[model samples]
Target chain A: MFPLSPILSPKGQGGGLRILTHVLALSPLAVLAWDFARGDLGANPIREVQFRTGKYTLVLLVLTLSCTPLSMLPGLKWVARFRRSLGLYAFAYAGLHFLNFIGLDYGFNLRLLREDIFEKRYAFVGLAAFLSLLPLAVTSGSGWARRLGKKREQLHRLIYLAAILTIVHFAWQDKAKTVEPLVYGGVVAGLLLVRVVGWVRRAARGTGSQTSSKEP
Target chain B: MDKIRSSEITPEHIYLGRRQFLVGAGALTASLVFLGGCRRLSELAPTPEADFCGSATAGATSDELGDPLSACDAATHYNNFYEFSLEKDDVAELARGFKTSPWTVQVGGLVNKPKTFDVDDLRRNFPPEERVYRMRCVEAWSVVVPWLGFPLAKLLKEVEPTSKAKYVRFESLHDPKQMPGQKDRSFQWPYIEGLRLDEAMHDLTLLATGMYGKPMPPQNGAPIRLVVPWKYGFKNIKSIVKIDLVEEMPTSLWTAFAPQEYGFYANVNPDVSHPRWSQSSERRLGERARRETIPFNGYAEKVARLYEGMDLRTSY
Candidate 1:
C-alpha cells in the first residue's frame, strides 16, 4: 500500500498550532452570533453581515494563497501547515456569505437568485466563485484524494480562478475605485505571481532532470 | 422495521419535546424583557412637544402638514453617502466629536458682499422657521424631515450676487484630522455641490441648522446644511465651509466621479432611474414596508414648475 499517513495523520506534537487556527476561524462566527443574540444588527443587518462575511472571506482566501510564499521565509516554515485549514475557513465564510445573500437579501426566491446571477455582473462573479469552490470543497477529503489519484492537484488548481473571480466581484460591486478593493487586488496579484514563478521553476527542473537521464 | 421496533419510547421524541418547551419559555422571556425595555425607554424619552421650534404661529398645526412620526422616521435613516467610517453606524458615533461652536461660513465668488458670518450670527440674523418637506436619497430610500432653518433665498438676498453669477456652489468641511474620510483621495476633499441660480433662490430651499426638535445632530450636519426638497439628499451638502456664487457649472463630487451614475440636477423623479439601480420604490424606516417614490418626492406641485419644458430624464 502507498504511504498515506504523512498527509492524513494529524500533527501529534504541534497540536497547539491546530488549536490556534481553530480559534481564529471561530472568532468571526462567535462575534456574529453575539451580535445576533444582542439584536445589534444595525439598520440594515442583512447587508452589514453580508458585506462583513464577504470581506473576511476574501481576506482569508488571500491569506491562504500567501502560505507558500510565506513558508519560503526561514522563520515562517510553520505557515505551510495552516494553508489547508485557512483555505477551508475561507470556503466556510464564503458559504455563509452566499447563504446570507440568498436567505436574508433574496429570501430564498430562486427566480430572483437566478436573475441576479444572470443579470448582475457582480452577482455573476460571486456565484462563479462560490460554484468553483464547491468541487474543491467536496474533494477535500483524503478518501476523495485517493479516488482522484493524480487529478486531485489538478482539480485544486481551480482555487486560483476562484480568487480572481472573487476579486472581480469586489471590484465591480464598488461604485468607486476605493482603497479597499485596490489593496485586495494588489495582494492577490502578488500571491498569484509567486505561485506562477514557483510552478515555472518546478517545471524547468523536471524538464532538466528528464533530459539529463535520457542523454545518459 | 420489525427489528427496530421496541416497547420503550425513543429518546429522540423526548428530546424534541424538551426542545420545544425550552423554545416556548425562551420566547416568553424575550417578550417580557422587550416590553420592560420599551417601557423604560418610553419613561426616559421626553414627551413629543406639539411644536418643535415654538415658532409655529396660530393656524400652523401638525395634522395640517402630516404625521410627525413619519416625518421624524424619514429624517433619521435616509442620509447622504458620507462614508466617514467603515461601518454605517459609525457616522452618528464619530460625528459627536465634531466641534460646531464658533463655526463660520464664507460667502464669496461673484457676490458683491464677500464676507464670513459666524453660525450664531447667521442664526440670529436669519431666524429659522419650521418647514415640513420630503427628503429623497439617491440610494432609493427617503424620509419626510421637519427642517427648522431660514430660507436659502433670504441668505442669498443678503449677499447680493452679480447678474453674471448663474450658479451657486457649496463646499463641505475638509479637515482630514476631523473628517477622517477626507484623508483618503477616493473623493476630492471639501466635497463640492452646486445649484442653478433659480433653484438656489427658491423660497422652499433652506439652510437648515436644526431638525426634529433640538439643534441639528452632528451627523445630520450640525451648525448648517442645505435642504433642497426637490433634489436628492446628496445635493444638500452638510457641514458647509464656503458658498461661491459662480458663473459656470461647478464640478460636483458625485458627478465628477461618475457622471453616468449621478447627474448634475439629481432631481427626485421616480421615472428617471439611476444607472446601476432602480429608483421606482423606496423603503420607509422600520420593518419591511416600502412605498413608491413620487415625482419631486411628492412636492411636484410646488417645485415642478422650476423644471418646466426641461426633460427630467436627461436632467436626472
Candidate 2:
C-alpha cells in the first residue's frame, strides 16, 4: 500500500504541486504589474489596483477557510497543508490594498491619513481588519503555532471577525450598487455558520476540539 | 476620497475608436431662454440669430467661471450606464457594439398632441446649442463637459403638454443584445427617470444629442439623452426612448431601487447627503483632489428657487 504523505511542504520541491501553488499565488501580482505598465488599468488606475487587490484578498481568505472542511474528508488531509500559505497570500494582498489607498489617496500624509482614520468609518474598520490579520500573518510559521499550542488557534479565530469587518468596510463604500457587497457578505456568513455548526456538534459530543478539523 | 496616479500610471485607451479630445463647439449658442413673450405652446421658431434679434436675444454664457472641460476620453470612458454595465470601464466595452441609429423618442401621456419623432428630426427641429455644464454624480465624482443639444422645454412645448401633466418621465432602451448587463436582472429593465414640469421647462434642462461637438458615444448614451446640470448625473437619463408627461410624480430608476439614497428631485445640494456617503465634497475627474461641492453644482442662482420652502434633508 502506498503511504499517504499528510504534511505537504507548501514551499518545498518535494511535491510539484508546491511549485504550481507558488506560481498560481504570485501570478496575479505579475499580471497586475503588466497591466499597470501597459496602462490597461483604465481611467482610474489607483481605484483599479485597490479594488482588484481587495477582491483577491477576500477570495484567498475564503479559500483558506475552506481548506479545513476539505481536509476533514478521507484521503484529502493534504489540503490542510496549504492553509498557512493561502492565509499569508491573503495578508499580502490586503497589505497591497491598504498601501494603494494610503499612497494614492493621502500621498503618505500622516496628518491627512489620521484625519481620514477618524472621519471615514470604513477606513477605521479596514485598519482594524488589517491589524487583526497582522498577528496571524506574523505567527503563520509552524514553529510559533507549536509553541503557543491551543492559544494560537484561538487567536486565529479572529480571522472570521476580520472577514466580516472587511465586508462591512467594502459594503459601506459601495453606495450605488449594494447587491454585490451583500452577496459577498452572505458567502462569508455561510462559511462561518458552517464552521460553527460543526463546532457545536463536536461540543455536544463532548469532544470539543478547539483547533481545526485536521489539527495534527 | 481623491486619488493621485503615479507618473508611471498613465491611462491608455482600452477601447478602440474612443475620442481623445473634445471637438470645438462651432454651431452652438448657449441661449438661456428658448421661448420669449408672445409664444404659444404649439408655435415653433428657428434659432434666433444673434445679429438679427439685437436686444431681444436671449443671453448666453459668454464667460466661463470654472476650470477647463473634462477630456473627451475621461467623459466617455468613465460613465455610469447601468443598462450596459455597472463598472465605468466595462460599459465602454459592452456598449461598443450597440447600434444608435433609427431611434425615435415617443412623447405621450396627458399631452395635447402625442408625437413620435425620429431622433434626427428632433435635432433638426430644435437647433442644437452648446452648453458647458458641470455634471456631479451621487458617487461624489464630477466632470465639466460641452454638451450640444437644444432646450428640453422646446420638445415638451412641441408636444403641448396638458395642464394636468405635472411630471416628465424619461425611459431608456432596454434591449439586452445591445446592452449586455440587462441579462443580470439586477436592476429593473428599461431604466426610467423623471423631472417635475417646471424643472423640465428650465432653460438649463437639455435634450443632449451630442457631447464634445460630436454625436453622443453609445456608452455615453447615444441617439438622445437629457441633461439637467444642477441635478445628480443619474437624473440625466440616457438613450431615452419615451417622454411621458404624467399627472402625479413618476418613480425613477434610482429612487425606485433605493428610495433612501436617491430622491425624486436629486437636485445637487451640498447640505443633503446620501444616506451612505457625504455629498458635501466632490472629486473632479482630471483633478484628483477633493473639492467642496457647491449648492446646485454652483448654479444655485438659477435653480435654488425651484426647491424654495422645501426641506432639503427630508426631500433628499
Candidate 3:
C-alpha cells in the first residue's frame, strides 16, 4: 500500500511481480537443497524431504487459489498473473513429493508401488491429486490455452477437485494429530465458499434482467 | 561397549542451547504462576545431577544384531509419547518441565504383597543393566537403542502375582496440567496398556530407567517405562504410575481406540500388514535406505515361542 512502483513496476508489464513470485516459489527448494547438502535434514531425512515437499505443494496450491479472489479487489488485479506460475510450482513440488515416495521410500519397486496404489487409501488419493494436476501443468503454456479456448477453462476447473483430493490425502496420512490438515481444509473451504457465493449472485442478477426485459 | 562416533552426536552448542531454553522456560512458567496467585499445576524439579544407572558396575553390549546404536539425540528428541505431544519432535521440548523425581509406582491388584515402591527405592533395589534392543514402530520406522534397566520379571517377582493374575495392566500419569495432550478428548486420559502375564514376566521385557548412558529424558518417559522389544512401540507404555495384575485381559489404549488396527498382542509380524500401510519394510533413522522389517523386530528367535500355537495373523 505504501508504494506500488517497487512491487508492480509501472512500465514492466508485471515484471516485478513475476520476479517476486519466482523468488517466493524457488526459495523453499533452495533451502531444502541447502539443508540436504549440509546434512541437517534430521533423523528421518527421507520422511523430512517428503513432508516438506508435500507441505510446500499445499501452500502454493492455496496461494494459487487465492489469486482469483484477490484479483476481484480494486488494487489487486495484478495477482491473477501470478496464478499460473504458482500452480506450476505446486505441481513441481508434488512431482518431487511423489518421486521421494516411490524412489527414496519404496526403492522404485514396481510390485510394491502397484500394491501401494491399490491398497493404501492415502497413496491412492495422492496419486489422483497428482494426475489431476498433470493436465493443468502441461496446458499452462499460453499457446495451449489459446488452442483449447473455452475447453481450457473447463479442464482447469479440475484444480478445485485436485485441491480437495490433496487435503484428503494429507488428512488420511496423519496418524493422530489432525489439526494441521483440518486447518488447510478450512482455508480451502472458505476460498471455495467465496467463489460459490459470487456465482449465486451473478446468476440471480442475470435472471432479474431477463425477466425485466421480457415484461417490457 | 561400542561408543557412538563423535560426528554422529548432536553438536554440544545446540544441545546446551536446548537445555538453556528449557531452564528459561521453566523459570518463566514459575514466575507467571507465582504472580497469578495460583498453585502451579506441577513445578519442574531441578535436574538430577547423575543418572540412576550411573552406579551400575555391570557391563553392556552393543546392539544384539550388531547394528549401530541410533544417535543419542535422535533417541531422546524424537518420540511418540502422545501424553506429552502428538508431534514427534515437539515431545522433547513439551515434556521438559515434567516431574520425574519424587515419584512412586503402586503395585497391587492380585499381588500377594501389594506395595507402593518409591522410584528411587526401585532403582536401588533392582540394579540397572544395559540392553541394546531394536525398537520397531507401527509407522514403519525403526531404531536401535541401548537402554539401561532391569528385566520387568525382576520387579514382578518381588511382588508375587497371585494365580488369578492373568494380565499386567500399566497406567500412565493423568495430570492434565502437566500433560497437555491429556486435555484433549480425542483419547481417553491416563493412557493404559497391558501385557499377558507371561509376556510381562519374559526375560527380555525391561523396565527402562535410562538410555545412552544418561537418565531417561522426559520425552522418552522418565522415572520408568516399559520396553517390550518383541512388540510394536505403542505396546511399550511410558511414565507408568500404576501396575495392576488383573484376572482378565486388559485393553491397551490403541487396542481400545482402533481394535482392528491395533490388537491386544501387537507382536511385530511383517507378513501381517497394518490396515493403512505395509509393515514389510521400515525406514531406519539415520540410514539412507529402508530395510526389510523382521518378525518380532529381530527378536523372534528369543521370543517367538511365546506365540507358537496362536495364529499371528488373527491375533494381529
Candidate 4:
C-alpha cells in the first residue's frame, strides 16, 4: 500500500518512502530501547538485546537483498533507493549485536572473545557476515559513488555474500527450531536464484555486449 | 481417564519421600500466591496454576544455593516445544487442542520388572513435590521453575534396575494428530532422551508432571516429562511415555538428531560453548542481565563426579 514514486523521485532520492523505510527499519531498536527503559526485557536484558539486534540485522539483510529484486519489477525501480538505508541499518544492528555479545556478555574477556570469534563456528560465521557487510556499509554513499565509479558496483556486490553468510549464520545458530531459519534461508535462496537466473540470461545474450545491466 | 488429582499425593517410598523431604524441614509453604486467585489462564498473561503444595516445606536448590523462581507467564510462553510449533507464542495456542489424558508410560528395556504404568499409576506410586530448579536451554536462555514431581531415581528403583541397565532412555508421546510440529519431521517422532544409569539415579533428576504446583500445561509437556536440571532443556524431554533402561548409553532425540551439535550429556558447562554460540553465560527468563552459567547449572557438587574422568568438551 506504500506509494514509492514521491520518495524515490529522480531528483529527490531521500523522499517520503525513504524516510518511512528508515523509520520502519530502525523502529525495532526503538521498541527495544523502550523495553530496556521499562525493564521489560524479561530476566536477561543482555541476552534479549543481543537476540533482538541480531534478529534485526538478519531481517534487514534479507530485506536488503529483496530490494534489488523489487527494483527489477516493473514500476518498482524506485525501491532501490531504499536499499542503502536498509543496508546501513542492517550494519548498525549487526554492530550493536556484536558489541552486546563482546561487551556485555563476555565483558571483553579477550581470551573468551577470541574463543567465540575464532573458535565457535556460529560466532565465526556471524562475525564473518558482519565483516563482509562492513565495506558495503561504508561505501553506501553518493560520495563513494563519485569517487569509485565502476569499482563501487563491484565492492557493493559483497552484499550478496553477506546475505548468504547471514542466512548460514542463522541456520547454524538455531538448535531445534529450523522452521524460521529455513524460511529465511528459503527467502535468501529465492533472492539468490533471482540473481543467478538474471546472470544466466545475460550470459546467454552474448559476451560482446558492453551494456550488461549492473545489478543494483 | 487416568488423571491424578491434587489429593492423591502418594507416599510410597524406597528413598526419601516427599514427606521426609518436606516435613523434615519443619515449616510449611506460606499462602503467598502471587497477584491473587483472580489470575486467569489466557493468551495474554500466564496464570501459573497454584503450586500443588502452596507451602512445600522442603526448599529445592541447585546445589546448596536457591534458584529465584521464574515468572510462570514467561516460562509457559517462551517454551521450545517444537512438537507443536516453532514460534514460542504458537506453542500455547497450537497446543491448546492437545489431549494429555489416557497417557501411559512403558517402563521397559533392561529393567527387572518391565511394566506399563498409566499416568494415575505414576502419580499413585510417586508423590510429586515442588522443586525450584534452574532450567537452562541450549539456546542460552534459562528459568528457575517450581516443578511438581518426584526423583526419576525413585521410579527406576521401583521397577528394580537390572545390573545390565547402564542407561535410562526417556521417550515423549508420539501423536501426530495432537502434536502438529511432528508433521514436519523437524525432529524424530516421539522425542527420546537419556541419562547414564548413575545420572538417572541421582536425586536431582526428576520426572516432572506439573509446574508452578498445578498439573503441567500441555504446552510444557503435559502428562509427564523429565527434568534434568544440569542438562539443557531439550534433555528434559516432554510428554514422556517410555522409560527404557538399556545396556548401552542411549542416543537422545538431540544427540541422534545432530550428534555434532548436541551431546548425550548436555551438562551446563559455560566453558564448553555450543558450536553456534557462546554458552559462557545465559539470560535467565524474565530478567535482564546475562548471568555467568554455572558448571552443571550450579549442581556440580552433586553431578560433576559422574564425569570425573570424562572430557566434557568432546562428549558435550
Instruction: Output the number of the lDDT-best candidate.
Output: 3
Better of 1 and 3 by DockQ: 3
* TM-score winner: 3
DockQ score, prediction 2: 0.07
Error of 2 at B252 (Å): 0.2
Ranking by DockQ: 3, 4, 2, 1
TM-score leaderboard ranking: 3, 2, 4, 1
Q: What are the RMSD figures for all models against the true structure?
A: 13.0, 16.7, 14.3, 18.3
For candidate 3, give the lDDT: 0.80
lDDT of 4 by residue, B1-316 (tens): 9889856855545222442333222111211111111112222353333232343333443424655676676777677888888666457667875787888889989877888889877888888888888888887788888888999888888789888888988888787888888898767777888889999999998998887767878888898998989898889989888888898888877777888778888888887867775688777776545677888998888888899889898888
Model 4 Cα shift for residue A18 (angstroms): 3.4
Q: For candidate 2, write residues A1-216 as lDDT tens digits.
A: 012212454333224444445556676777678677866665666777887788777767776777777667665566676678888988999999999878775467675567567666877898898999999998889899899877898799888988888888888777555586787788788878877887777776655554444343
Residue-level lDDT of model 1, residues B1-316, one tens digit each, is 5576565656865754454454345334533432331222232333233233343231223422463334442244334436365344556546656888879999999989988989999889989888777676776555556678998888888889998999999998887887777776767777889999999999889999988756776777877999998788889999888999999998899888888778889988877755433366565544343456777877778888888899888878
Q: How do the predictions measure up, each by TM-score?
A: 0.74, 0.77, 0.83, 0.77
After aligning candidate 3 to the native by TM-score, how far in Å is the CA of A153 from where it should be? 0.5
- Per residue, candidate 3 scores C-alpha lDDT tens digits across A1-216 of 114535555564445445656766777787678667766665677887888889888888887887787777765565576789889999999999999999998899887778768778888999999999999999999999889986887688799889999999998888774697999899999998887776677667777575322100
lDDT of every predicted structure (CA atoms): 0.72, 0.75, 0.80, 0.75
TM-score of chain B of each: 0.77, 0.79, 0.81, 0.80
lDDT of 3 by residue, B185-258 (tens): 88877899999999999999999988877677788899899999989999999999999999999988888777
Identify the candidate with maximal DockQ.
3
